[model samples]
Target: MPRENSFSDSEGRSLTPDPEDEIHYEEPAAEAASPTYSIRTPWSPTGHTVPHPFSASRRSLHSRAPHPIPGWQNLTPKEKFRITVRRVMAMHRGASILTTGGRVGAEPGVDPRRASADALYSHISQDCVIEVVDYSAVRSSFGRMTNKEFVNFMGDKSASQREPWVKVRWINIGGMSWDVIKAVSIKYNLHPLALEDVFHGHKQNRSKADYYSRHLFLRILCHELGDPDYSPSGHSAAQGSTLTGEPRSMSPEPMRDEDRLNGVKGGDVDEEKTMYGTPPTSRQSTTKRRRNPLLPTNRRDVDGMPKASNSASNLARLLKREGDVKDARKERQVEEVSIEALKQGERVNVKVSPMFLFLFRDGTVISIHPEPDLDFTVPITQRLRSRDTVLRTSADPSLLVHALLDLIVDRSLQVIDEYHTKINKFERRILLKPKMRTVRELHILSGDLILHKRTLEPIKTLIYGLRRYDVDRCAALIDMSDPANANTKVVGFMSHKSKIYLADVFDHMEYILTSLDMFTSISENLIDYTFNLASYEMNEVMRRLTLATIIFLPLTLLTGYFGMNFEAMWSVQNNSDWLFWKIAIPLMIFIIPVFMYSDLTRVFHFIQKKMVTKQAVKQYKRA
Candidate 1:
């Protein structure tokens, strides 16, 4: 037996036992079965003791009916229920009002610094959709998931920060869903304010580029030609309201040349004459296209942000717009639309939808669109499928970004070409025979061209910002002496090689802008020419009418005088010896020359010049 204080061996097993260690030993069974709360009150008299009600309920400690959250313990049933309801409601709907973002209305003293959705993504609309694509240079994977799976996958990624993995992941979210957004934000530390713009007021967010700790956020409008026969549920944005903030006329078949020539193709319904007592006839109907409220001001990318400036100032603004990490709320408001407008908009072939992109440091490019038109990004995906392509071989995500932008320009170019071809046809026809409807169609086309111009203008600024970022980032990476340079490494999404490639995209944009300018000029000229040609034809008709009146008026007066009832006129009786021709010929020669003053003078001048030439030739021969 060892004493109370004993020496211990240094090896694996200490060969000593002390009586003082756990002087009154307790068994594991006793500890497990111990009462959760002591059977004594802190302020009670020495001998008095009261047992907890929960302790009396059951012998097992785990069987206690306890509130799971610590905060809920002090709350009543109604308050707890209220909190629970708020948490649930928060996920399905946006804040009834805008909130900068914290646990709103409840959870007192909750820190506003950390981005929190008390019920985590309670504001996400149930109908929102998500798609994810993860790829690297060596291998790739694509999957479309429900919000639940997405949430779970993101949670795993967030948890497994220790995974020794490096791959370029591209996650594309098609609709506005805060839960999906929150999941991605957690997976990658996305700035909260940017997330706010993801669904900001449900308005078409302005084109912008903002930098954050982890990624570069870019928001731009993608102008897609909508299906001529397709109709969307709820609300439609296709209206007279164009990206250029101009309204297109309801000219039927603005794009079709033959439609204008053939006059209004009969949609004229033969109905019984009721109110007006006349059958309805084909008449030009005004377009139901009005200004869409969803067509937000061309500035506000985040929360009512102002108009974006030019390249230099815009690049400076990118840094200024980098908002604080934690912020709140989402989703543009759905505008109330009438049935008629929806019908009219069904054929609205031009659509402008918001497109978002997140370029991560690890070469991940996350793109979000409101439409499921995956075919638009086909060029990028096709090239990415082949590992030997420049996009994959380069491993710089900016190339992917460039490809995406270039795709936009390419599509825009297609649209421009279509408009150009139609204009050329119209120009040829208008020159031959001008009409009012032609003018209207030309006007509609002009509006569309302007819309494309304005929508595409931002891309130029966006490219400039990207190029500027590359320059600044390169400078940041080169200088290691400054403390500010610590953050410079986190960025570099745009490398020098990427910038060089982007230059070609810039040129394409320039070409597009120039083409739009030329088209605008051509359209204006065609309009003027139509009016001028019509005016010239009108003047010619008036001149011929006046000449006919002049020629007929004198004959009427002469006949009246010659055939008087008194029978005293010599010419009418027997003295008509070619007098009518003699009198009229001399008068006609004098009067006819009045209208042809310039032609008469030119003929006289030609005769004198011809005589002088003949005289000169005879004089030379005699000499």
Candidate 2:
């Protein structure tokens, strides 16, 4: 209660509050640091409103501002939504995220953009089969195993201890599931980059051969064509078609080597007679006889499998002899297959797949198939089971690899032959009747050829790499010592025999590549040829219409002039004599000469010549 200007607390201070004593409120640190959004719409008390992170105001701010994601910065709203979805998927269990132009040292927790250039994989599906073939010179075992069994067998030291003489192991993995791939990756210490390449499911993936510290990784695409018209049980369709400049001749009798050796050029046997003096049956009787269950099963070996004699005691001897003969025959045929002229005109539909192989210097091969349907490994498996086959004799898993590649190459050639047949048919159809539909089909055919060429080119490169492995440049990768002698064994090399055979396989691939190039060129030319033919036909149609118009134009004018009822239009309206002489004679004279004019006379022939010449040039270029 002191005076306002003179009051003080104990020491004569003022009783009124000082300016420094008043409180000054402060803004929160989090609120000040956080981003602010300008409210786009005013709130209403009646309407319920909940805070949304993706509110219009926040979205507007984000759209107007730069984002941190490198690739997401310029993306549209729709693209951003899609990217967000992809990000969510990447965040799921067992799925890895991939970034644009990623580096070569990416890790799990690091930023994807800063990570290495490896393919992203997800461990979702586990439908796969693992088969192991453990073999040596004397004994072999084959079985289909589970992932657990595979891991145990691969990791167990006691496996080798039990079978001390086991020289080679071949593991065939069908259907590339992430779990199986991951386990194998860990077991073999496979390079992460190589694993990335293996997991990538793209048609454009190149055929690559990478020599790692402990293994050689190879990836090859396999393609096959399907034809519904060709019956597998019927006569060889390939023998009837001659697209590859090969001829076909069908005779009532098939000539045998024994007949040729006996100096018999034409077959001595008649189609109607049997060797044991049995009368030939009529068509109906033959059909009925085939249906009769009493008839013994006269099965010939289509696959060159071992033949069993009816006698049980002699079954072993007969099979052994037959196997030896089959093995010898197959070996001889393998030598002749490359040189044999293949009759063309095969109609095939292509089924494309991929095969990935990892070959270790110790004669271990791990084959991974992305496509479960294509089993070219079956033949190799059969040979592995045969005692007299070269696969068993050599005891090399690399042989199996080569054999599989050969099968694929051979299959590709067959598909190409089918394409060749289709090309010929298309040419004939277009020549006989040209249409826009035909042109579209031709373009599609050309596209298919291009696709095949792209696929095969990579395989060609892989073969070339394999062929070069034995050269001076790749000698460091070869190991010539026994695997048990670790002191002399080299890690990243192939066996000498494997190298030699791979060169042969390389030759086959080169042939296929050359043929593919030819087909691609021909297909392109065919497309152009079809389009040109259509244009030429169109021009011919236009020319015919022009000719018809020229012929009828004068007559039309004369009729119109006479038909008009106006008084001054024509003086011959009522005078029949004048109309007949003046209009009719003059019209005939004009029309006759127009039909004989020099311009019209040579037009059709001139166009025909031009088109023919252009076609000739195109054909020459295609050749």
Q: Give all candidate RMSDs, comma-separated.
A: 22.0, 32.2
Candidate 1 residue-wise lDDT, 51-122, digit = tens: 211111111223333234434455557655644553333222222111212112222221111213212223
Alpha-carbon runs more than 4 Å astray in model 2: 1-122, 160-162, 226-349, 372-374, 469-492, 564-575, 582-596, 600-623
State the weakest 10-residue window (summed lDDT) of model 1: 285-294
Best by TM-score: 1
Any idea what lDDT model 2 has? 0.52
lDDT of 1 at 399: 78
Model 2 lDDT at residue 101: 11
Backbone clashes (count) for model 2: 13
